[model samples]
Target: MNFEYSDRSKALQEKLTAFMQEHIYPLERAYDDFVHANEWQVFPELERLKQLAKDAGLWNLFLPEEYGEFSEGLTNLEYAPLAAIMGKVYWASQVFNCSAPDTGNMEVLAKYGTPEQQDKWLKPLMNGEIRSGFMMTEPEVASSDATNIATSIVRDGDEYVINGRKWWTTGAMNPNTKVFIVMGKTDPNAARHVQQSMIIVPADAEGLKILRPLRVFGTHESPEGHAEIELDNVRVPASNLLVGEGAGFKIAQGRLGPGRIHHCMRLIGAAERALEMMCKRVTQRSTFGKDLSQYSSIRQEIAKSRCEIEQARLLTLAAADKIDRFGIKEAKDLIAMIKIVVPQMACTVVDRAIQIHGGLGVCQDTPLAMFWIYGRSIRIADGPDEVHMYQLGRNTIKSFN
Candidate 1:
């Protein structure tokens, strides 16, 4: 497939890069400090930065052009490099309203929600007036197979009752997260994939409780912390059910395909930044009368990181291009390949950068530590690496047969 980015994509890449350098890079350290010191509260400057992003026309870059008015008129292929630029800083995506859970949630709403449902939630979300959560994983289940999701959504006249516990519900802890797209069983006896359904539940609904903020590598990941939430008999209007009772799995697959592309590209950007840092650090330091850059070992690490980053980036771009030209089903293998490859590559590249940074690596002094954490954590997020590999291996064997 031709992977050359269009002139439009190249123009966006240049504009986004300049925006990041001018505004995001200067405030990176302050943003980190504020989030750490404040805990669930947003860094005060984020709203202003977001307005700047909107004014600069970089907002909602993740939504695909197929969504018409809701989208920025960019294809998945066109959005990939822009996402990579935003990925260099963990919080930068939020500035452009391109962060996940939200991005996935928005896609689901745009694709599946009824007109009224979209009016109520999607508009606020797209306008950056509200945030959202995707509640699917559970503490007791091996959620890699989503059919194992045991949350129950039972119908009752005018409303549906929801009872379940969800952990790693990203964005639930944010004060601005006003809604959740929750997945649960609506018909236990239905066919395997048809048993589950997704419904919208207001974050403030009665009987819903925020159990606690779950930490990743001991950091709160504040402002949008991953949360453990208990939905005890939570109820919402029956109108909130998306598509139909058996459509959860279908909706989820559609939502995740593009989201995975966004995540992988961002990971590549993080890896590129780490490698850049590693190269810079080596040149500025010395050991035993020899520069760190002069050592073959250091040079080898740099070379390996560069090669791995390029490989992952190319693979992710190929996946994006496929998703643009073909449906998600046709691009499934490539999607699974990136899901299996990118995070691991990012983890390895960031680890080498951390090693080069020495003590400063593990500490908050450099973004290297957070980059490593993001790359490593993502191996388990979305779908875990093992699940993708298992599916890909099966697909490969079937192709041969």
Candidate 2:
């Protein structure tokens, strides 16, 4: 495989790296301070950074021409490194309108929405005029199996009435989140995977209530908020239904391929940052008349971290390449393999960084603990590692047979 990055990708990567250093990295502390000070509102500085990124033509790097509405239209392989750079700073992706839930939502609308639907939401979403959330996982079901979701979207004349309780609906708590792409059972009697449908529900509709934000690891409140909300007889135009009455599963499969790749790339960035911090800490601190780096165990940890990061990076790029070359369905095994590997890799790398720093690493003074939490969350978020591992293992066994 030709693993080398193209000139176009390299140029964009350099530009993105420079933007992160000059704009994003410097704002890390300030971003934390802003979040702490105004825990309820969106960070004003992030919006400003978004404008800067847009003006520089660095927006929506994840959406390729296959979608037709993406600005720069970079392929998954081309976008991987730039996304890796953004992953280094958790909040950086939003500046370029490349962050999650919205990215997945946009991909769905672009691929499935009717002309009128695109005009209403897709255009504004591409411009980053508003934010959105996906509501598929329900509080009452084993959500990893989408077929188990209990939400119902029943037709009522010109509109569909939706009812269900959903948690971990990431981004729903943000006031800026104007829409929700909800998944529910439209025809429970239909075949297992075909029973569900996705519909656009306006955030302001009556009977819709965003209850509270669920904390990740008892600390961080995802700015958009991993939220619990009630959609009690919420109503939307029947025209809001995407693709058809039983297309939610299909839409999810299409959206999640790119979404998983984005997550894996971001995890690599996080792991790289943790390794940087670990090395800096180990070398700068002296203990027992020598730098911590001189300790054999610490040196080994650093070396091992480097090896792990390189391996995970290569695997993530391979997954991206597979998605670009073959459709997501065709690359399911690789996608599952990377999904299982990257987050676990990041968690290990960040945990080591924390250990090297002693107390400071686990404290707010350093981002290591937060990085660790983000990595750990992904282990359960989206889906669990056990689930991916099971699928990957089964695929491997089948291939051998």
Per lDDT, the best of the predicted structures is 1
lDDT of 1: 0.94
RMSD of 2: 1.1
Q: What is the lDDT of residue 18 in candidate 2?
A: 90
Q: What is the C-alpha lDDT of each candidate?
A: 0.94, 0.88
Candidate 2 clashes: the total is 0
Per-residue lDDT of 1-401 in model 2, one digit per residue for the tens? 56799899999999999989899999887786777667757887877899999988899888975775454767788898888899988778889999988999999988889999989998888899999999988888999878899999999999999999999988887778899899999999999999999999988999999888888877545467788999999989899999899998999888888899898898899999999988888889998999999999998999999999999888888888887787788889888988898999999999999999999987777778778887998898888899889889888999999
Candidate 2 lowest-lDDT run of ten: 64-73
TM-scores, each model vs. reference:
0.99, 0.98
Candidates in order: C-alpha RMSD to true structure: 0.6, 1.1
Error of 2 at 311 (Å): 0.7
